[model samples]
Target: MFRPLAVVLLLVSTEPAAAAGLDAASINDAAPPSVKLPGPHQVNASVARLEIMLDRAHFSPGEIDGKLGENARKAMIAFAGANGLSFDKAVTADLWSKLAASSDGAAIVNYTIAEADVKGPFLEKLPPKMESMKDLPALGYRSPREALAEKFHMSEELLQALNPGQKFDKAGDTIAVANVLDAGNPAPVARVEVDKTRQTLSTFDAAGKLVAFYPATVGSAEKPTPSGTLKVTAINKNPTYRYNPDYKFKGVKSKRPFTIKPGPNNPVGSMWINLSAEGYGIHGTPDPAKVSKAESHGCVRLTNWDAGRVAAGLAKGTPVTFVESAR
Candidate 1:
């Protein structure tokens, strides 16, 4: 069943709380100051640096918001486990050193806004309902800020906090952004694992070594995810979302089928890895922050960039196994 993609809409706060003590210099510092774990979701240079490093290492912290949120914490633990280090919800010096050593280069870098970035037949506003989206010409980003934020795997609020008073619509404008461009191609994925309990997706190489880890949003109670093994059938980029009446997704009143145009804001985001299961696939999401934090209808949801990476390393017959507990 192709159920409606449930998302916790991001309410961008007007307050500049995420901008506190956040500067390009601090974020680019070689030795970032230690950050306390289980802290509030406040913008801190240390957390930003950690997120960038983890992202570069292919252990995505999901929408680098410059905070030690649940996604970030999960990434840290997974990275530590892969590196033979013990982590217990704390960022010890050794763990920080290991993470820093795993990837080189500054976390934050300056990026000049380009003409293509600002030039958009941008949407003035997007309707909250899925049925209303089918009529639009293209479901492109609502604004340049949103486009840029997704470009660098950053939260819209974090991008704005990094460049206060600077409008993202202007070209030739240099601004601080997360340096999470391309982390390079990973090893060929021999198998893919989705742990529903942990809300994580991991790719393993032929030798059974963990290649990449990502926080994921699995299915909800109303529409639980499928169990057992599945295989990758196809990979689609910039995929259009088709809604079926059989899904009967909440908030969607339409009984007929419809298709939503392809764009970053598209319900399926940028990439879709079709699985052997009829209506189940591991796909990208428009809401990166909600990954692993929200419940999906049935499919496995990942950050758009993370999904792209996973798709790049996947093959047509690669096995995808879903489990309730860690294997």
Candidate 2:
């Protein structure tokens, strides 16, 4: 790994500048006290070790964004959980110590179709079609994180936790869908009902079985949840979000023509089920516990895990009836 030169190239706006270069002096002078290293520093052996562990554990940092963000934290937690290590979002010396000792290198744990059925959170069928790591470049996988997310049956958040430093090339190959059944006995089909007035999301299985229920953050009253029968028009894994300036919240200036690269910080957590109604889909949020109490721009928001499961469970063009909650 090349040692990144410490530099600070200040941008007046969020947009990328055509002529961008590192100002090592400016960055070194203004380095934040919290980071310890100067701003815009390159990946070193420490971060490299972190990245290798994360990748092996299957937390695809996508193109090694280098910045430690929420997705990375989630992956770290998952890795720690698997190892029976107590974890907090903040990085600790203990975590790094464990990371250095791990035998797994940078090799990703690829998911393949197996006879044993596995399931994802929110009821998404597991072992999503076996995709090749090589396919990532063709799929616009800008980062290894994105590529790994598509390859594994998980999200970039999981990847970020594993690797904190790396750059991703968005153009990656797509995987071939390999069928794998869920191991658990299929829960009864659900007849889901949404109540925007009450901000609730309910699911009923095929037998009208009440399998799951959750509180949701519905669209704001001003841009109320649309009223109509809808279907999940499409589903995407680790989808990139194009922020439309026209639809942005007031006082929130989006980096124009910017696409929120797919990862933990992605407004749409991981899987997105586009609805028959335009711009209205059931998706996940970076913050799940904060749902229901909050308001959405216009879509239904669930936890990232929940939304991904929902995406895996629902088929394209699945019928979804929309009606107000009796509440």
Each model's backbone clash number: 0, 44
For model 2, give the 10-residue run with minimal summed lDDT: 121-130
TM-score of each: 0.91, 0.44
Query: What digit string (tens of lDDT, one per residue) describes model 2 on residues 1-327?
Result: 011122222222121111122121221122211234312323222332344355433332222223333333334544555455655433455665565455332222323333221221121121121122112222232344443444443335433433333233222322221111121222432444666665655555776644444446778865677887788778888787766666765445553544555553356767687888877888876544356657788888876645655565567666665666443
Q: How well does candidate 1 score on lDDT at residue 232?
A: 99
TM-score of 1: 0.91
For this target, which candidate reaches the highest TM-score against the unseen true structure?
A: 1
What would you estimate as the lDDT of candidate 1?
0.82
Q: Estimate, for each residue in 221-297, the C-alpha lDDT of model 1 and write its tens digit.
A: 77889999999999999999999989887778999999999987788889999999887898888778899988887
| Model 1 CA deviation exceeding 4 Å by range | 1-20, 30-38
Point out where model 2 deviates above 4 Å. 1-190, 254-256
Report every candidate's CA lDDT: 0.82, 0.46
